[model samples]
Target: MKIIKNILFLVVLLSTLQGFSQEILTKKEALEIALENNFGVKIAKNNLEVAKNNKSIYNTGFLPTASISSGANYSNNNQTIDRQDGTSTSIDGAITQSYNASLNVNYTIFDGLGRKYNYQQLKETYNLTELEAKETIENTYLQLFTNYFQIAKLTKNKENLNEALSISKKRLLRAKYQYEYGQSTKLELLNAEVDVNNDSITLINANQLLSNAKRGLNLVLGIEKEVNYTVETNVDFTNILNFDELHQKMITNNTTLKQNEKNIAISEFNIKVNKSNYLPSLGLSTSYGWNKSQNPATSFLAASSSNGLNAGLSLSWSLFDGGSTKTNIANSKIALENQQILLEQQKITIDNTLKNTWENYQSQLFIINAQNKNVITTQNNFDRSKERFKLGQITSIEFRQAQINLINSKTALNNAKFDAKLTELQLLQLSGDILNVEF
Candidate 1:
């Protein structure tokens, strides 16, 4: 009775674990999960939030700063006064206490529109961060597409190995029957057995590879434990690259290039901000203060209280800073030029990538086409050889060769298909179409 209950408990536990552990997802679903949970995406999102916060009016130094403070102090002292006539008066144990509180406000009235430029720069920074987040999402989708399709390829390979193993088993069975009835030699039967064993080993290795592929996909999804999951058998390869469109869009919409452009804008804004130092800055400051003093030694200073408000308009300009302002403006202009140069350089690099990826994508398509014919021919040969061997018209060695050939051909076709799919994804990624991955 106890054993039965224990078995039931174990079964229930496993059932619950399996239910909780497995997370089946389609490509779209996986992408959605990765966008929400990926560390890169989350970090970029946080940086964007920071940029947004910095673009606020208070952060851009457009609002007045106000503060209040209070203080109290007490002191005990002895004092003496002497006159030129040589008579002196002394006082002992004179104690005094004072208290004061103040409220102050400072606002910049004008600074050559530096605050406006700063605000605009911060807004641009926020937009750049937004693009950065989008880029991260796009890159993440590319990675997911890769890992997802790799599993699909491995799964196909596993199926091929399984079918090969089944054929080997059938051959082994036939060989055993022939040997038992004295219709085949012991050597042929032994060879058949070896083929079955070899096939089994290959199948096992293929299964291990499939398992590893699943584990990698799980890791990409940020899942801690392995789970039962399957991906779409078909990979997307619908869109082909049009170089003219890509080149135009590359300069206009490429996130990295746009980020570079933003950098240049910031540098231009910085020049304006620094030029503001050349002009006198005007500010208004106001304070309301209260003070009271208690003094024992003098009547005028004893128990006096006063309260008043003071306001002032202040002007400050750096007359000279050892030519640092000129140097800063020059550097800002240089930096802007540097960013522009980098944007052009990026275009050159992207041109190379597009051309090469387009070629590779085309090459893989040709390979798939070539391998399709090979697969058909190999399958025909394998079928004919199997029949001939069963009728004792061909040796087991000939049949085995045909079997291996067919397997290789099928495997090559699947590889070519997968390679083409990946290259297609790469093309999409380079053109920033991965951002629109859906359906």
Candidate 2:
């Protein structure tokens, strides 16, 4: 019977190993796929490109504008004129023709330096968009790693369930032989049968969980079709995290905080832009024009033509205009103040989050250590209990307890290890180092 049990265990192990014939999807591959295919990352990149395109001299009103225009008109008229000397002259169907053409150029030479400030504002806006894009990519990294590790966890769970089911079947088979030989009661055999049935159901549920987990990973990868693959079960823990260093990095490198800093700069530029409205503006305009007219009914001139170049300078001061400029400047100042306040608030929020995440990571690491020891102990207990049960030295219930302990310990250890990995990832994310994680 013992020889048969050993053979059964080896067969089950070999079958389970064979079931994992799919390709291995590594962490690096998952991240690379997400970089190329994730919807959020692509959208964020497009937005950054838009911001970059907007950072141009034309958009900031820093360039001159030129226009060319031409027109012609022809008309026929019946006319009658009475002179002062009591003489009258009448004409019919007199032809008239006129033509005009012009080229104009206008430039704002100075507007209290508003153009400079506007250009600076555009630059700051582009920077802010860059930070936003970085934030989105980092967030996608977190989500991808989270989903990838979840699949790994569920896969390990299915393996554990398979082993448990195998053990239950072996137990049931031994129970049958003992009862047939009149060494064990029917009650023992029935109990073993019940355990086998329960284990089978648990394994079925585990398989469903694994399938769902794989689908989740596929969604994160932006794969429209579902794919089956195995993952590397080994998770390397990061143990060198320092709260002080991480907090400092969060202040300097965190995308949200950096975006807020850019916002503050943009607000400052806006205030300058509005204040410039109070000063006088200077502009330059130049044009070249040609005009010609022909009238057969004219008394003095039959045809006339003229051409000239014109130039002018304009100076306009907003002495008073219903206080619109003043009001705008005041509003801009208020907005800048609000941005400063928000920056402070964001700092506080990030500080608290970093503290909490660091503590949780430490706790998970400790739990992983404890579970490692527990798994070892439970495995040894299960091995000894199996031998005792074969020698008819322990009851079925006692043996079942040992088996349950082993299974639970393995499950717990797997959960702990993966949970710790996730917590470590959170720490990296909070520190703005998620993209730098090692495979």
Candidate 3:
């Protein structure tokens, strides 16, 4: 019994420790973890590695290649040969065995500059893959930050709703007391009860929304369902960005722009590579081998039983490919021109995006300020109405109107703040500066 109890205790202790070991993530930490651990990012990084390896393969063309090969054969002869004695000799060999081994080397002394152009093209391709991975990371970070801020905003909104609900409950209690003392009508108490119930429903909905938003954020972070996270709500938005500076940064640092530039370079290299096909290619190959046979008369086997070395240079020219090479070169040039056009379009699009986001951010900032003032004004009106209700100077309907107005104002203010923050984040993202921002 003692042993069983001890084992059970140890099991419970290990379970508790495992439960406690789950990560409690903050917004920054969660974003960092997602960047490092997300499946999408991992796959993108692997693709980039593949591209790099392909570049290495292209680079190997500059180096000499050597390989060793060996083989064995067995045969039964069924023929006759004339010997030096001018007599027919029967070559009745029974199970003759032969073996061969060789080391072959090949080197491209010249190849119409094809290898050089191919290597350059592959390097550009590898760089483009890296840029694509960076673009993926930027997109992921934007999504993570958006969700993070949304959760924080929802939390604040829920807190405000709870406060409003508490106020409603207090008002209900006061109305009930007044009705019992014959100082307030039954209708007044009924209205207060209705307000409390409504606030309670709203609070419940807010709680549900907060829960769903948290789950969504966790999903984005690739965390388990049981994990919990808290967002840092105190984000700074005071750093004013100049439009010109943002545009310059986007042009200089945006991964998409870099990728497009690499595409253009790759297109140019493709044209060169195709043009090189019109020229002749030169190469050298050499081989040395040894062979052995059990029947010396049937195989070329001297006392040394070896084959001599052989080396040669080869040349290959397309000469004429029915205009195929010319067509390829034309297609490559057209592609390069298209890429230039695409680059221009991309620049225009980025500029428009930046301008629109900046304008929206400015508009939201003003709305937030105005909503803040409105909240204060509505709060003051509610306070005055409350005092008047207590002194019997205002009716319950008038007091309730003031309370509803205050709630509406607070909700509007919260929404405006959330929108302002969201727009600011968008601007930062469009400018390619979101990752550099320290939350």
Candidate 4:
């Protein structure tokens, strides 16, 4: 009795643990966790930050640059001198030291608008980086959402299987009782036991599949180990959207298309920047320094020991350079044209994708409606079959057939619902409105 009591306590404890583990996680929470913890999104965000830093460096070109220098030097000299008496004499000079320090400053007065254009280009590049990050995030979110729904659907499937297994167990027990009372043959009892074992095997397989699905969800959510969580099975798809409206939204809001547009703008700016290279560049530079001679005899002591300042404006024009600059300008123009062609292609692709997904969504909705009706019909038939069997008007085989039909119908209905919901999600994603949809 004590051993039995312990077994009962263990079963209760396990049941309690499982109940606690089945806490439902909403879609919003899952997405938030993925965004916060996903490694790929973190890497993309870091890349964008690097691009922003690069832009800042380029922007510093507008600020004046200054520098300071200090140095020490020593020198010695040997020479021959002619005296007044017409005799040559040799003289050795001692070492001398000097120290000097200076500061220099340069400010750009003009550079043929090169700096402005380059800054603009860098700004555009920064924006492109941000767009790339957004694209990465959106793609990651889509994957997460798909996996979340799949796990939810699988969990529901397992529940159905478990319910069917319980029903099989009860039928097995009834068959055994009938056999004991001589109301049924041994064959019927054996068949019922076989069905129960088969159901148990199916349940085991379903449990394994559920575990795998949970692991996949955990991977997407950036969790290290397995976690027990439930997904909300209710996804409302009552809002019907027009294909034309979806296409329009995709054209306006698609990140990839917008990124390509930015690329075209960048290419145009590149051409301008390359063309600016042909014009003259003008700049102002100034420097102040103290100069000292290690040999006092060779230095002009009056000015050498003093500081001097100089400032001047200079202009440079590149007349020719092996046609490289011109070639680059032409290349930029070609790239811009290519981007234009790509933009058109992308628009067509998006339009086609939206149409395909919208049609698929409609088809799945129809399947779901049909499956729902079939479920009702199958359930009614199963009820009537059970009644007929109990009244001895039908065979046990017929009753089992009805049960199988009902199970199949239920399974099909569940699958159809899942497919319909997935299709809806795809449509919303294609329309660039998945993030805006309320759960």
Candidate 5:
């Protein structure tokens, strides 16, 4: 019975593997998986949550603090006592007990409006984090899409390899038949066998490449288990032949650019926060307390009780700090200027990037169009060469060349399509619209 159970488990495992090995993945499905499971996305989202929590007003010391405390103590000690009649007595132990309790409240009445500025700084910082998370998502999706399309190309190349191998096999068979009929030399048969072997090896290598590509794609999707899957051979592009619209969108919506703007605002607020140190600060504080004392030696005469409320207003100012505040303000001004420069530099960089990717998209489109006809012609040429080789009208070398041409054309077209997909996604990314990826 144990052996039967083991056999049943083996059968089930095999069935699962067979089914999983035939799974197909789509671009949108892969994107959804990466968005949910990718580590970087998860970390960015956590950072955004932290920033949001930091921007809270109550948490940032905006409100007053109130506390209540109670304490008690008892003491015993030896003491000497003297009376006015010139008689003295030594007490072995004298005991005393006391209790006190207080309720206190403190509030910052004024601090050059520093708390208000701090609150604005935190709000801007939170906005910066939000944009940073968006940038991470956009960049990660580009990488994922690139890997996915790579797998698509590898799949097509594998298909091309298989077709070439099949052709070699048929040609080898034909060569043998011709030699047996005294129509081909022994050298021709030998060459035919060599070509067939070479094609098989090439096909094997192509399969390995395809497997690696699939593994890369799975890693991008955050998948840990090894399973085989096929990707669709479709990458589409729309050529706008214009960068003006993309440029405008990028200026308004680009994540990094917007993040830089937030940084500038934070720096301006920092200047205010630093300058606040020059002004005097005012504080309001109040306390209510109760105290009681009892003496065991003479409880009737030494017992006492006091309860009251006290309040006060305090003010302070920093007269000097070895030029530290001045230095900080100057540094803040410099930092603000630097941030504004970076913001402008980023605009220039993004403009250059957009133009380059636009040109690349157009170039890939041209290559795809050119290769489309080339592949059709090569396929026709290969079919004819196959017939000619079988009929002894062409040599195996000539037929191999035709097969290579067909494979090259097909591979080139696939690569061009994949390149176009990359540029299209890049353009969309620069335009701040990558999350809307389709097809």
Candidate 6:
């Protein structure tokens, strides 16, 4: 009775430990964690902020620049002077002091509206960064989704292996009993033992794979410490997408396309900026200054003080810069052309990818349905074979074959479901609809 009590206590303790170790990590939770901690997403967000700051008029050269400067200095020196009339004079501890302060302002009065174009360019750059950030976020989401579903797949595979192992164990027990009663040969019992060993090894490997997969997911979640978690095994494939609608969304909302459009706009603005060099630029400059100086020993004018305000206008035109301006404008136009070409190429590539992925997703769904029916059929065969083996109507080898078939069918079904979900996710990503998926 005492031993029984100890065994019960140990069982309860292990159950508690297992419960504490397992965490339920849902897809939403994983994505939320990644959004907050992913390095790529963080960098993209920072880039967006920098672009937003640059979009300001002050950074675009439309605002005047103002600055203030001040300085003070003191010096002591021993001096000797020789007069022109043949008289010599010496002075000791001659002290001098000087102070100066100034405030200056400069504004570009005109530059062929270059500042206006530049400001527009900055705004376009900000828009580009926004798209870039969205792209990064969507990519991250897709990665997490893939990893999460992989875990689910492995989890289901492990369960299938476990079930197979359990069946092998039961067969081993029946073989042992039959041999002890002289109803089975020793060779048959040995074969059952071997099969049990194989199943156990397979299950061990499955467990190891599951552990490694979990560790990979933890890394993606940016968790420095390994966390034990179990994900949901059910794959959802509820999003039914229409091809025409998806294509339209891809054109209007695709991050890469939007970014390319912004780039083209910026390149056009850049050409304008370079062309502005052909016209003269006028600038206004104004300054207020104060100066004071004193000297204890001097031949003439021992001290001086000055204070004034000054203003000036400057104009500049580049008549010949070795054709630099022309080259720059040409390059800008070429860059704009490249952007347009890339946009077209991307549209084609994305369209083809979308069609392929959509077809693949549909095929996966059909495969899953077929595998489901196969699992049911194989499971019935295994059950019947188990009964027949017990009645000596089938050999142990035949029963084992039936069991293996069941396991394989289940594995294929599990894989098919997850693969379909992943393909669907790819479709959404291509359409830029992944960003709309709520965590």
Which predicted model would earn the best TM-score?
2
Off by over 4 Å in 5: 1-21, 83-89, 238-241, 298-301
Full ranking by TM-score: 2, 5, 4, 6, 3, 1
Instruction: Give lDDT tens digits, candidate 4, residues 1-439.
Output: 3563576467558957997877788988988888898888889889999889878954648888999989998767776667679997665784567888898898877777777888888889989999888878877777887788787777777777766776666677778778889999999888888887887798789878777877888888887755566788765774856877878888888888889999998998889889988888878889899877545443334234668998988888889989999899999999999999999999899788888888888888888889889989989998898788778787777877888888888888888887788777777766667767776
Q: Can you tell me which runs of candidate 2 are displaced by over 4 Å?
A: 1-21
lDDT (Cα, tens digit) per residue for candidate 2, span 321-376 = 88988899889889989999999999999899889988888898898889889999
How does candidate 4 score on lDDT?
Answer: 0.80
* Best by the lDDT measure: 2
By the lDDT metric, which is better: model 4 or model 5?
5
List the lowest-lDDT window of 10 residues for candidate 1: 1-10
Count of clashing residue pairs in every prediction: 0, 0, 0, 0, 0, 0
lDDT of 6 by residue, 24-133 (tens): 89888888898898888899999999998999866988789999999999988888888899987787888889999999999999998888888998999898899899
- What is the C-alpha local distance difference test score of candidate 6? 0.87
Local error of candidate 4 at residue 147 (angstroms): 0.5
Q: What is the C-alpha local distance difference test score of each model?
A: 0.82, 0.88, 0.81, 0.80, 0.85, 0.87
Better structure of 5 and 6 per TM-score: 5
TM-score of 4: 0.90
- Residue ranges of candidate 4 with Cα displaced over 4 Å: 1-17, 57-60, 76-93, 238-240, 293-304
- Report the alpha-carbon TM-score of model 5 versus the true structure: 0.91
Tell me the deviation in Å of residue 167 in model 1.
0.8
